[model samples]
Target: MVEDTQQPQAQNGAQPQVKMQILAQFIRDLSFENAVATKGAPQGEVQPEITVQVSLDARKRGADHQYEVMTKFRVTSSNKSDNTTLFLAELDYGGVFHIEGVPEDQLHPFLMIECPRILFPFVRRIISDLTRDGGFPPFNMDPVDFVALYRQELQRRAQSQQTEAAPAADQRLS
Candidate 1:
């Protein structure tokens, strides 16, 4: 026999309680290179074309109900015409989160998608400051679509699993 240990809050027709908190946020790593200063100013006014690449990672911490999520950004600027380098900025930022009430199976997406979504503004601000201080206009990053990114990652993982399984199945048939 099993006992039903339902909370009063949920018995009233409300959803289960979910708790999330950002325990800490910090810059894990940062690097910026100003080509205009090092390589000398390029001839003529510069048309800077900036490209920003982003990635995310997450893992459980030693403490229970705590996880660490990291967001990495690689920003590159180049002249659209002659393609000379302007500057490059790379930043790795991390956030420590204290979360509860989410089920184990859903935690992975909660960490990868929701946690980073919560941390993105800080990451964007840092990048903007880094670029502005490096002598360029403030680089405000566009909003990232975490849901789409999560979906793409899931699809990629599924494809990789299928690819791996196909070879093993072939070997088994031999």
Candidate 2:
């Protein structure tokens, strides 16, 4: 007579599974202003320029094996004078993802590419909405290719290391 507890459960293994879900997303901070609006758009015939800066971070959530990915963006648009902040915005967005029984080889790509890909649309919407509310036409970011972006970033870092090494080599030669 075999004990009921001795019976194997669900394929005799821990069961391969992967689940990625967004826990929450919100604007940690947002600021927008049109200083030139009161000045009637100002004169001097200067073309408008917008600068965008983006940053991303990821961390593990303790023993649960869960992960959190946070992405932030800062965009500022102004005339040549730089005194007017035509459109300025700062957004902090993140998501909580659960991954289990996934192979190590696939984990890197899942976090770098898939996770950010999922969170990007929400972040983009926030930027668009903020621009519209600031009295300017909606400023929508172009769709990002996380796979390509990640590859490019890796390449950039590699090149930067090579450049840094070159300087050290030059010092040795001198």
Candidate 3:
């Protein structure tokens, strides 16, 4: 007699599993600009301050389990003393993903953090390459803390909801 072997389900009768796959990655948009320093400006007088902004967005594809995540980066360099622009770079990189087994309640955080983490290295490389090719030193972006970013976004949303609900509550009380 052959005994059947199968994975046991959780106590709640649901399978506990999570799976994510990247189908493809591509650059949705890329732009680079190099601005000349003011004439007679001390050459390399001071290192320019670089500011980088990052954002993540995700949407469901036509397929049930398929989704697309976009990671965008905007970088700017400027001399604080004179407020002169040095260089600017913007990139919108995207990845197509297939996710399964994640509960609906947890899907948002998973997509925002995990999907972007997978796409960041490629986006970083593109930015570095663009800067170097644009006759400037390669600007490598520091690794982002997606968890922190997600938490901040959650807080922002909570605050906005509270603010919106407060006015409605006030109206009902009046």
Best by the lDDT measure = 1
Query: Residue 148, candidate 3: how far off, in angstroms?
Result: 0.3
lDDT by residue (70-148, candidate 2, tens digit) is: 7778888777665565667788888888877667788876787888888898888888998888777788888777888
TM-score of predicted structure 2: 0.72
Model 1 residue 98 lDDT score: 95
- Give lDDT tens digits, candidate 3, residues 58-172: 9999998999999989999888777778888999999999999898999999999999998988988999999999878999899999999999999999999999999999999
At residue 1, candidate 1 shows an lDDT of 100
- Of the two candidates 2 and 3, the one with more favorable TM-score, higher being better, is 3
Write down the TM-score of every candidate: 0.87, 0.72, 0.88
Q: 20-133, model 1: which lDDT tens digit per residue? A: 998999999999999999999889877989898888999999999999999999999999878999999999999999998887889899998999899999989999999999
Give per-residue lDDT, candidate 2, residue 172. 100
Candidate 1 lDDT (Cα, 0 to 1): 0.92
Which 10-residue span in candidate 1 carries the lowest summed lDDT?
2-11
Each candidate: what lDDT? 0.92, 0.76, 0.89
Rank candidates by lDDT, best first: 1, 3, 2
Winner on lDDT between 1 and 2 is 1
Better of 1 and 3 by TM-score: 3
After superposing candidate 1, which stretches have Cα over 4 Å from the reference? Answer: 1-6, 9-15, 172-174
